[model samples]
Target: MAIGRAKIKSVGAAQSPLLGAAMFTPAVLYILLLVAGPFFLAIFYAFSDARIGNTEMHYVGLENFRSILKSPSFRIAIRNSFIFTICSQIVVIVGANILAIALEKTFRGRGFIRFLILLPWVAPIALGAIGWKWILDSIYSVISWVLVALHFYKPFNAPMWLGEPHLAIASVLLVHSWRLMPFSTVILLAGRTAIPKDIPEAAAVDGAGFWRTQFQIIIPMMRPILSVAVLFGLIFTFTDMTVVYILTAGGPFDSTQTLPSLAFAMGIQGSDLAAGAAISLFLVPLLIIIAYFMLRVAHRAEVN
Candidate 1:
């Protein structure tokens, strides 16, 4: 009986490595097929004279990059991408923190409130953006109707949320913030819950007020979680074209154009695949740097 049990244990140990590899194979294939394949294809297209419906291609070196560099719309798209991403992140972090704090406390209807808050993030982004489009429409806007009823503006003179350049940009930023805030809030709320209950109780006993406890004690403890939230938010906001595409279509003369939207407009819509690929590649370096620093912060927090 002892020898039979020993033989079974040896067989289990021998199969463990194969079991792990079998489980991991799907994820590896997924990345290669879905992620790495497109990445490499984009690189090839960026360097070659590739265009939509082209039957043949030739290596163009830096020609595509040079061509896009001279376009004024490219510069504007780059500027708008940064503005929307940074501004939305700031708004999301602050708003999410407030929401997380409020929801941390037990209250009546908390679950229902949380579900309502999470709706924007959980719903398809295109659907949310389309809804926002109607809400911000120039003539038939619900917001404009409310404003006119409140005498904030005349019936015909209501602000053009998606028409004027500045307002269009603001409208896009608002949509981005609204979509991202709930995700950040859930992350922060989870982080808050992970803190030992005794830590805050001790702070209270030591006469530390709410602000002091939050800023000094709670916030510092959540550095890793905050870093993760900001990293994901940055990537989502930076690469997102749905909100801008659906809301403004980079309209009012491309005031709300972002890099992703510009890439789509140039590559897919305009049929200049090479130029679009090159424009899309511009996002790689900035994202890499952001990811590196954010990951380092997360690692340091883990160590400490």
Candidate 2:
């Protein structure tokens, strides 16, 4: 009896790894079908001359790519997209960090403060942009009215916030950051909370000032979470189009066009499905690079 029981126990232990693998197999297969499958299809469509109206798809080699590279509008859209993405991420990351830190501290009405800050993030981006559009209108902007009242500018002197190139870019960046900051802030706040208070206290007891403790101890400890926040922020900001689409539609003469918006214009709106697919596929390479580096960093972070 004892020998038979031992054999059964050993067999169960041996099957555990296989069972775990089998459990995850469904999720792995789901991801492959849902993500990898569409990705390859998009790549094929991007490279080929696949049109909506045409029944035949002839591979034109690099002509589509060449057109994307040479077209002045495409170049401008790419540049603007980069600018908007970078600027928005900067604002979101910095502002989120500050807000997260502030909210992490015990204070009066901290809960209320957090709720208010999170409202913008919870709101729909398209609706928010539309509301902001009205507020930023050349003739009806409340900001313009305030400026006029304060003698900062006359009734008709308000700058064209969405109708001008530089101003439009700034406006879109501001809108995107405002909408995204709250979400990032919440994420960072969760990260900050995971940090042990003893770490900072120990640093402080060792003759480290508040600033030093924050930089050398607190920030270091929070690196993993911050990395996560940054990664999320980057991915969201990189692919965002709703706010830009509703607010400016790459307006002010396509000054605020990002890759997603440009892709929509070229693919869906312009009925050039192949070009849109190509532009959409452009995001994959960047995502792959980012994912590689982020995973490497995350792994190191875990080991540390």
Candidate 3:
């Protein structure tokens, strides 16, 4: 009986590695098929003259890249992409910090308020953008209607939220900020709660005021969490096209054209696949750098 049990134990141990491999196989296949495959294909398409109707492609080297670089719209798209991403991140981080702090305190209706705040992040992007588009429409805008009713401006001369270039850019920025703020807020809130209650109480005992405690102690402690939030926000905002496409369509003379939107316009909409691919390739290097730093921060946080 003892010898039989020993043999069974050996068989079980031998199956362990095979079992682990079986569990991991699906994830590896998923990444290869969906992530790596598309990435390498994009690189191939970017290098070749791949048009929508073309049955064959020829290697054009850097021609597509050069053509996009010389285009004025491409330059504008790059500029606007940076502007929207940076500005929206700043807004999201600051606003999220504030919201997180406020939500940390117990108050009446706190749960309901959190639900309302999270609605934007939970809802589909297309739906949110479409809602904002109607809200900011020139003639039927609720904001303009309210202003006109209060005699802020003439009915016919109401401010055009999406009609003017600066306004359109601002509108797009607002939508981006709105969509991302709740997600960052949740991240920050989790960070804040993860902190031991003793730290802040000890700071209070030392006569540290709210601002001093927050800026000096709380913020520094939450650095890793903040890095994760900011990096994720940057990637999401940088790569997003649905919001821009639905809200402004990069309109008002292309004042709000972002890299992703321009890529869609040139590649899919314009039928110049190679040019579109080239435009999208610009995003890869920046994203990879951000992802590397994010992983580093996460590792450090885990170690500490």
- Tens digits of per-residue lDDT for model 3, 272-303: 99999899999998899998998899899889
Tens digit per residue, CA lDDT, model 2, 50-136 = 877888888877777888888777787788767877788888888887898789889999989999998887887788899999988
Residue-level lDDT tens digits of model 1 in 1-304: 9999999889879997998799999999999999899889999999999888988999999998898889888999999999999999999999999999999999999999999999999999999999999999989999999999999998799999999999999999999999999999999999999999999999999999999999999999998899889999999999999999999888879778889999999999999898899999999999999889887977887798
List of clashing residue pairs for candidate 2:
none
For model 1, give the RMSD to the true fold.
Answer: 2.8
Top candidate when judged by TM-score against the true structure: 3
| TM-score per candidate | 0.91, 0.85, 0.93
List candidate 3 segments past 4 Å from native.
1-12, 16-18
Residue 180, candidate 3: C-alpha displacement in angstroms:
0.8
lDDT of prediction 2: 0.84
Clashing pairs in 3: none
